[model samples]
Target: MVELNEVFETNTMIRDENLDVRTITMGIGLLDCCDSDVDILCDNIYKKITAVAKDLVKIGDEIGIDYGIPIINKRISVTPISLVGASSCRTRNDFVKIAETLERAACNVGVNFLGGYSALVQKGMSAADRLLIESIPYALANTEHICSSVSLASTKTGIDMDAVKLMGRVIKETAEATKDRDSIGCAKLVVFCNPADDNPFMAGAFHGVTETDTVINVGVSGPGVVKNAISKVKGQNFEVLCETVKKTAFKVTRVGQLVAKEASRRLNVPFGIVDLSLAPTPAIGDSIADIIQEMGVEYVGAPGTTAALAILNDQVKKGGVMASSYVGGLSGAFIPVSEDRSMAYAAEIGALSIDKLEAMTCVCSVGLDMIPIPGDTPAETISGIIADEMAIGMVNQKTTAVRLIPVIGKKAGETVEFGGLLGNSTIMPVNKYGCKDFIDRGGRIPAPIHSFKN
Candidate 1:
């Protein structure tokens, strides 16, 4: 059943094409750690996370060494803290204490990041959820590894304009709280519509209350591999281009399958799913934009860009589904501006604007990711942006998210260096007109007519 040439081809993909497992995330539930006392709650969370994930980093490294796969990150996702700490977190500081405990657990477990500092308020926010949300700025400003998300909209529940307005202010406060580091704290926060639970990615990963207690989800990425495959057929017809992307995605996903099965067997955790997201990096050629360019777009925001991206997204999903036993977690192409070198360059040169990126998100995977606007951008404007993206996801019944940073002290055309996987972002100007009246009239935006199919 084994083939030598296939092995060699995978080796070449890893060595030359930038193929790698982006993350191996372990999702753990904290429901049993809930307590009525804040101190006891913090203690219970720390012990549970540390006990369950003590070997996460070690086993991940061992597996990478044994399989010759470059595992970029080993992380953890827990049940949303708002739910877990509801009885104990009476104030914002109480929630912040839980965040510090999570940061400590992350350090002790040696994880690259720890997610699920979150609250889900798609329909409405509870008292505890509000407290956790209020504490986000302080929590993120103080912690290094903690990542947070808020689910403010879903197709079934529509967009929560109340949460949207609050999140705009929360994002602004987060930027101000961590202004010394180019407002890096906001980079660790994401606002989502219909977010997936088994996502092995940061800033949006959370162990859904409905999910199993412990499971391992692996995220695989290979934009460079996809690009290299289709580049062989440059100027070819659509049929040829699509076939190349599908076959290339199949090969890349099989690597993820192998790693997932092996890691699950060794760790005694359930294999969740393989997320074949084709997430791009700062490295040259390892970019979704490059793949789009090879597919006939002059740049990512060109006239034909959305069509190219749609084709790529559909084909990648088709191929990945064929290769993996189970596939989930935003399994398509991600177009984060800050994380991809070519996309970021496109924004810098005015080839890509936030408006074009929003259009692309209508077809691509997630939305408005890693975009930096000027600090002077109003909270109402940010709320308007969130409302727009959430409306897209609500109407189309697809998952979309925003990870925007109002980098303090930076203006349009200026750059903030985030470094590492986050890369760098050039601030872009927002619309000059104010949307204060629109945001101030905050109430829940009702679900679409299609959502009445009960």
Candidate 2:
């Protein structure tokens, strides 16, 4: 038997300093729930969800208390509702039923968010895909805890111009539906380019068909740990800062492995993968931007920020892979503007803009997360941002996404306070300059010139 202490301890002084696994998500595959009869399909989904996750919340609570760290959320991800509902639903009302059933099931089982209310049309939109996108505003307006996403592009295939245009329209409609409430419905939606199937993160995670049936994936978060590590360094030597981040990441990943093993054991579910992302809340001291600032940058969007993040992301993957046998998902750093206090503060103070955020996304885990734009920004402009972000992932061959909320009636620098985990944000300005020519070009940029390296 391996000694756990020997495995966890090394030259690093940091060893599980108030660390915790943030989420234990049950990825219940609902592909088998596709029956011709809508009612039968609904029943099958409900039964499977309850049966697999009956003791999920209880097990999570026990493990959390035992480890003396709070498990922030218990969640579920199902098969993409588009594919699962396609067989049973012939109309818009049928899609509504699917969304409502998912919402009710999650509330009944005490799951915070039920993901997989999504569609993947990175190549082209199906009739079913069109209907799914059309119903999002209504489904999100009606349901309580259902999240939706649309993956419009992928490196494997290429950009889908038609789907991108459709998603831009869908985003506008979703925002219009929830305009009175800080566009909260838009808050639940994510637009992705190269989204991962096993992502345990919220509002963007869905059960991609490539995933196994009912696996358990963990998302570990601790920007506080990373910031503390950098705070000890009195002066700026970029290399030293990188080493500190690497050593700190090793300890953080070790804690994640222990918590994940414990959670898997108690839930009776096989452990899937650990997402070593430094996810943040609106709370002070928990921001990834704060970690960068502590490393000697004036603010997160400064000149060296992207380079700093590139080193941090690479070092994190290096340490996390050494600590865990299976490390997956967006296992880097996350810098959601509204969700991270320091990032939001930077936007508020005029240190970070959409241009700078674009550059940072190349180095960070996800792109332009939880950013608020003016409600009247042209639909074309929103699509343009998506195209630009997707192009970065396509050229670099990595996962990149966008979750921009066009907060209705809000303008640049205006704060919108969302009183909970949804967080708050000051609306960031989009480029007044148009990308009409580039966006209208409408053809796949033919994978990177470097992708032919083979």
Candidate 3:
């Protein structure tokens, strides 16, 4: 039970620390909506999503108002459309039609984003998976509010280099398809290694087959709260700093638990899990970099940046588990470049490079998120980058993903404005060296020997 003192503490977090529930995502399974006819299948999908999520926005708003907590986004995740549309979708256009239906449903239901226009090709690709991956550029370009992800690697199955090579081309095509809008389509696409089923965050959330028909998942944000808590312990030893962070994360996550239960009760959906991710926004105080700096780093991406991130990530999880009975999803510090103001600043000043960001991902939540490269980057180069990240996740047996935006008509030093929660970013340079020969060797990378644990 939450004590009265805890209620007051949560109020302080909200009032001063930019505390908010990042997203209240509803995961709707679409296996039941499958049909042999394309039009009929699209109709079934549209109807099911609309009906299931009609009240999601209303309930989320009411919850935020009643509890005086800010719920920033109401979103939805559906079963991967590649599987649902495979029997009926004869061509890439047919899958694009499904994407349009998803966008329409998301708009109708008043949700900001609808994820799961996705394909799973971790080990290899089915014909349907290949079609979905090929269609992603057109699908995402033609629609707004629809997000797509493709899984190309996993710890147990290893990396699918065929899919990796294909996705590198797909990402380039996606950027070209939406070049008029700052290549925003690529922003909605994610490539994953070891993707999770119940992740409340996007652009890589999908309802895994293991989930219930419908459920509510909450992603909580409290980087500012953490930063504030750590500041008070300045000059203290590492032990004191770690304990302070843990206690701060505990208080922040308790608020999330309260909101999740209330939302689940009101919406009449099973409470799935509370994602205790310290999601950072473009806002000044709400930055993972700032928290790292408060922990005494000179700047993010400095010499000791990775170590600071490791401490923050571990303590956040340790404390969050104490607060919530079910804590899943990518629960750690997020260091998305364009989304965090301090990280963006660091990148612009050359204090942070793509290499440093990649190194930091080894210790953080996700990999290479919202990073903008030059417009002329080669597809093979992008694939090489994805391969490196996939290898990390496969070896470490953790979730990692890539969301890269190659802004068209822009060079490394220029800035592209996506605005809103996506924020703006100065294009970071990539290594000019060619990796075409390496990427051309398209076959599976065998799973590590450690994966033999039965």
Candidate 4:
């Protein structure tokens, strides 16, 4: 475990400030909750969750206070609802009820978010799955704390054009449904390609079938620590910045590994991966973009910002791997436009462009995240971006995902503030060129040549 009082010398690359882990999610496998009767299955799920997770918030708070490091969120992820409810849910209403139960369970425990109300129909969708997908807008808008996601592609089965189209429509409706609340409900939703099973982050986490019955995973976030490391060497050369990031990330991941193991031990659950993502908050001076800007750029999205981010991302992975044997999730620097204040500022000033953002995703954690587009942008355009990012991940055989917000009645350059953790961002323009023909191809883009290891 990381010693909180390890004092640092002024010249050391690593220094512990207010750095802390964001959330340590406990995923409880709910596949056994499946039943022939929808109501009975829902009842069983609520009972199981309530019984086991009743003390989640209390226990997490105790640990956080004891360690003097704030655990910002305590949450849970369950098996994808479509999989767990496959035997029970014959109609869309049944899925909605199940979603409601999940929401209520989270609220009962004071957990802020409950993920895995999702499906993994990367290649195709079953009828029940399709209905569940269609109902996301209503479910998310109406529920208080439910999050949803769908994996539309993987390195093995490739991208599913039809599922992508349906998800695009769902994204649009989800935005409209919560437009009154600045689309706050939409913030709880994520669309993924090559999603990770042990992710402790919000909006994209799920308990995959291969996971233990229950496991606790921690997501340690330290953008301020990383920014501090970069700022200390502002006038240094690029190589110096990379080395600084690697050394700082080593210390940061050490803290995460310690926190994760301790939390799991306290909970009496098996320890899971430590998601070493540089997840940002709306707080000023606490962003990955700020780190890049501190490294000599006038602002984020300047000429060398993407390259700098690439270096930071790589070094973080290298250092984190050395610190923990169980490093996983989207473990890198996240450049979500809305989540990072500097990223939003860059987009507002036109320093960041869609193409540049796409390139950044090639090296960073996820793709096209928290990006808002003009409401009128065609569904095909959304599918095009999804396809493009998924293609990159598939070809590279790494996890990449998109969590776009098609902000209704909002256009490029317009700023929308969702408030709180969702943060604020100026909308970005998408390519005007149409992709109707490509999207209409509407079949799996076969797994890349390199994916065939056998």
Candidate 5:
């Protein structure tokens, strides 16, 4: 049992340290709502989502009030639309209709964003998957609350070069469609390799086909809290630094554990897991980069940065896992450049670069996350980048994702403001050299030799 007294001690963390629950995501299964009739499918989906998530926002708010834990966003995830709408969807437009329906449900239920406008074709693509992936640009651009993701690779199934190549075009198209909004549609579209079924974070969350009918997963953010703890032991040895991060992570996860349990019990939905990722915000004093800097690195891309990130990520998992009964998702330190001000600044001044960011993802929770690059970045180049990240996740047997917004009409070194938690981004330069030849060799990368463990 968690010491209830420890929960009250978080008042300081909440008030001063920018500690808050990032999101309370309710994952609703929609397989039962699938239908051969497109209209019926859309209706069934909207009805099911609205009915199941009717009280989601209210309950989430109440939990925040009751526990003095500021729950920032209430969101939802559903079964991957490629599978859920397979019986009904024949064309790309049909999938767009479902995306519109999902937007309606999210608006009615008052959630900030609803995920699972997604496809899972890590090995190969079915006709439905192809249609869904093709429709992503329009689906995301037309809907404000709907987010889309496509899984292009996985550990067991190797990399799907076709999907990787396709997503490059899709991402570019999404940017073009939403160019007026600083290519924000691409902000809501992420491509993943080995995505988590119960991730409460956005841009890549989907209710897996393996999940129950309904579930609640919460992602907790406390970068400032951890940073403050580390600051207390300034000039301390490595042993003290690791212990501080671990102990702070334990307390932070307990807070999430308490909130998740309460939300589940109140809504009569099973509690899924607590994702104790030190997800940062645009606010000052709340940055994963700051935590790394505190550890020793002068800047994020400097030497020894990856080692610091590795220590922070591992210690967070070790301590967070022990605090909650079930700990899952991409639980570690998030390094989204846009969301974390320090990271964005690092890129702005050339203290960070795309190549260094790719290397850092080897130790971080998510890969190449929320990075905005030049508008003129070639689609094949984007595919090359995705292929590289997928290769890392494939060989490492871990979840990695890419949310690159090739900001339309924007040049490198320019800034685009997304505001809110999405924050501002300094458009980073992509490699000018073309990768069309490499990307055009369209065949899957086979799974690593060690994947035959079964």
Candidate 6:
């Protein structure tokens, strides 16, 4: 099955095209760690996560060395903390204490991040869910590696406007709490509609109840590889262009498949899916927007951007499905504003707006990610933004999420640097129109009629 030419092609992609495995995430269930006492519960969670993921970083580094393919991050996801800590947590401080324990465990294991400090309240919130949501700002401010997410909408169940409103205030508080650090705490928090349980990405990843005790999932990144392939067929027709992208995606995903299998075998954990998401970084030439421009769009937010993105997302799934039998977890293109250099430039120049980003999310993987807005922006306005995005995912039955940062004391056109993978962003302007009355009448938005398939 090994061919010399194919091997050479892969080597070229790695050396020049920014092709790499984005993450090797270990999903560890934490339901068994629950107890009736907060201290005991946190201790059990710490022990379980450390015991299961003790060797994750070592194995990830060893695999990268042996295979000569870069593995960017090693992370962990546990069961949603709300479910596991509900009976034990008496107050918001109890949740904060648990967050501290998670931070320690992540540091001890040497992982880049730890997720599942989350609550799933798509339709309604329990008493425990409210405590967790209220404590998010403080929890995130106190911990460095702990990430938080709250699910407020789904297709089967309607959007929880109450939770959406609460999240708006929570996000504002999170920004204020971390203002000294350029509001970095909000960067680690995500709001989701139809969130995926098996996602290998940060801020939105959790081990669903359906999963086993342990599993290994991989996320692949290759915007540069796809863009390079598109350049070769510059003057070709649509058929040729689509074929080129599909073939390039096949090669990129094969690398992820190989890494996933090897990591699972070495760790003695069951292999999960390969998430073929085109996750970009702050590095130039490795942007999803560049891939769109290669498809003939003048710029990222131009007229034909959405159409080009639709093609890229569809063909990537087509190619990825053929490369690996298990392709899941938001397996498409991601267009986070701060993480992608070109997208951030577009926003800085006023070429992109929040409305255009929302339109693009209808076809892309995640939505409205890493966007910075003015500090004085109203909480109702943020809730309106989340409501609109949730409507899109609910109607289309696709996953959409929001990670907005209301940078305290920052205005539009001003830059805030978050450093590292989060990069920097210029705060974008939002509509001044008020939607307080609309958000004040809080109730669930009814599910779509198409959800009656049963």
> Ten consecutive residues with minimal summed lDDT in candidate 2?
9-18
Q: Between which residue pairs do clashes occur in model 1? A: none
- Residue 365's lDDT within candidate 2 is 89
lDDT of 4 by residue, 383-418 (tens): 888888888887777788888887887788888987
Please provide, for model 2 over 128-187, each residue's C-alpha lDDT reduced to its tens digit, 9 standing for 90 to 100.
888888899999989878999888877777778777766777788889999888888888
lDDT of 3: 0.93
List clash counts for every candidate, in order. Answer: 0, 0, 0, 0, 0, 0
lDDT of 1 by residue, 1-454 (tens): 6699999999999999999999999999999998899999999999999998988889999989998999999999999999999998889999999999999999999999999999999999999999999999999999999999999999999999999999999999999999999999999999999999889998899999888999999999999899999989998899999999999999999999999998899889999999999899998879999999888888889899999999999999999999999999999999989999999999998999999999999988889999989988888899999999999999999999999999988899999889999998788778888889999998999999998887
* Model 2 accuracy (lDDT, Cα): 0.83
- Compared to the true structure, candidate 6 yields what TM-score? 0.99
**What is the TM-score of each predicted model, taking all chains together?**
0.99, 0.94, 0.99, 0.95, 0.98, 0.99
lDDT by residue (312-390, candidate 3, tens digit) is 9999999999999999999998889999999999999899999999999999988999999998999999999999999
As for candidate 2, its clashing pairs are: none
Better of 2 and 5 by TM-score: 5
RMSD of each: 0.8, 2.8, 0.9, 2.3, 1.1, 0.7
Which stretch of 10 consecutive residues in model 6 shows the poorest summed lDDT? 416-425
Per-model CA lDDT versus the true structure: 0.93, 0.83, 0.93, 0.84, 0.93, 0.93
Determine which window of 10 residues in candidate 4 has minimal summed lDDT: 7-16
